[model samples]
Target: MLIGDVARHSGVSTRMLRHYDALGLVRPTGRTVGGYREYSAEDVRRIFHVESLRSLGLTLKQIGRALEDPDFTPSALVGDLIRWTEERLEREQELLERLRAVDASAPTGWQDVLRIVELMQGLDSTSAARRQQAVLTRPEGVPVPAELLAAAVLAESDPLVAGALRWALARSGGDGVAALTAGARSEDVDVRRRAVLAIAGTAEAPGAAAVLADALGDPDPTVRGHAALASGRRGVTAAVPVLVGMVVEGSHDVEAAEILGTLSQDPGCAERILAALTGELAAPTADSATRIRLTQALVELSGDTGREALRRLARDDDRAVALVASAFVAVLDERSPEVPGAEVP
Candidate 1:
């Protein structure tokens, strides 16, 4: 057959066939009397083999070497190809993680309305009500149909979607803590963060503390921060040690300070939080915001010590920290002084 006939039969382009021929990778058997290239059925079969190797991610050079060796083991080539595929998959997964982080940083819009609507239908009526509130409040305006929302919330079983819906509900003043807790186990980091936030907001939910505790160790700093905040907001004293550890050890020091401030409202958590900020914990550089939060937490946990710390921090180089400390001290001064015999102030 001619080059065109061989190209069509083997599903290889004519240009590629010429290139392979030039490389001696899969040359035609012979030339016709007219000096035209001639390809036999055997050549077509070899072309198919080359296409298969290319599909398996082998370079043209590697495929040529394999094709040259008649005694080559197909099993060995397939094993190497499997390893290559796994590496590609791992790289793709990493890219996907980075993309997800980027996406979360941006604003949500109508482009995901259909997908969100579809996912929302898998929830119950109460859950759907919460999602509706969130959708209506969305900056993009409500473009999703009511039926689609109801159906998607009712039909889908995906934990990620469920977690998002439950989070929307909690944000809308609905009690979806049960749903959020259920979604905390999802492989999706965003879902877990949303679940942690929801559970933290709902004070009455059972097992919410445990879920938030587990989330403190999440690989993603964003998730860990949210988890820390949830633990603090819920006033889970058991999480004090963890929250203090985060303030001292976490990479996101700003978030850690915020969580520490929240946790410091509990008098029992005072010592741990103070230790985190005082250089005893040896956390990396303490920024103005972190120092401010630490001072605020100390005030909430221990009035005298916190006031003293605030007085000292008021002399800090960072104007923002000094300003906050000054403001807190002024507020404390404006309040009536406690008399020795006065009722509990």
Candidate 2:
């Protein structure tokens, strides 16, 4: 196939094909006497794989290395991509914190100001954690500011806050399980939240299951959502039932749907949860946001099932419910998976 045919077959633009060729990432199988690129069927396959890895955030260099080495594993590549993503997230968090600080300094209503202040404080804590991660992971020999880092760690007990601190410590080659577990059980809601979130990031911890289970029933939906997400992260089979139950009976449908979505990432749990949702059981909640999330989760589980459910829900007379349902239908339709082994959207 010529360059145009190759581009059409691979769904990559001609410009990108040239760029890949230039980088020696995906060279053409042959060249015509006229000097045009000619790609083999095998070349098309390689291009598609390259696109998939690029979509997963692999840099061109990383992709080249992986492609060049027969022993390179997809899991190893994904791990590297995840590390890059975390670094980007940390930088974005820093920029967000700086923006929040400016907003806090501006004149505003007392309530708004207070909220901004709280947000700024949280951002500061998150940035501190990111910095700690950098210090631990990067090869640059700059020493971390221990006193400042300690103060950042001790500032407040928000689940995200505590989780970040614990994550930083762990990344920095320290095991602070005792302190993290203590924080998880603290009387302070923030501290407990942090503990739950932090433990979720680790592979397995002794008391994490109990702590997360306790958090599942927290009065605050924020706490409940974090706990439920953490439980899903732990990948405990017991959590699947509890998370599904929350979807059915919890007042906060949005959070419950999020937990359910997390659980549905497991194939068995996904099938069971979809059956429960599409069954004759009463709709979990009438809230549009909740319904939208549930519909999306179902779609993720099985597009046809999710599409049918959304169509049924869209028939409701409630304007908000119908609107969100329609949106869900549109999203699924656009991204619907191919029936006979082709990509959906």
Q: List, residue by residue over 13-132, the lDDT tens digit for candidate 1.
A: 999999999999888999999988999889888999989878889999889888887887778778888998999999898556444433432426645644443333333334645544
Candidate 2 residue spans exceeding 4 A from truth: 1-164, 172-174, 203-210, 217-220, 240-262, 265-268, 275-285, 330-345
RMSD of each: 12.7, 27.6
lDDT for model 2, on a 0 to 1 scale? 0.61
Task: Give each model's whole-structure lDDT.
Answer: 0.61, 0.61
In order of appearance, the predictions have TM-scores of: 0.43, 0.43
- Residue 48 lDDT, candidate 2, scale 0-100: 89
**Candidate 2 on 1-345: residue-level lDDT in tens?**
998988877788999999999999989999999999999888888898899878888888888888898887888668777898999999998767555444534534556454444434444544656544433443333222222233345454444544555555455333444446666666777656655556566535555577677767766655666666667655654555555555555444555566666666677777777777665234644465545445545555433545566676677566676677777767766786424542221
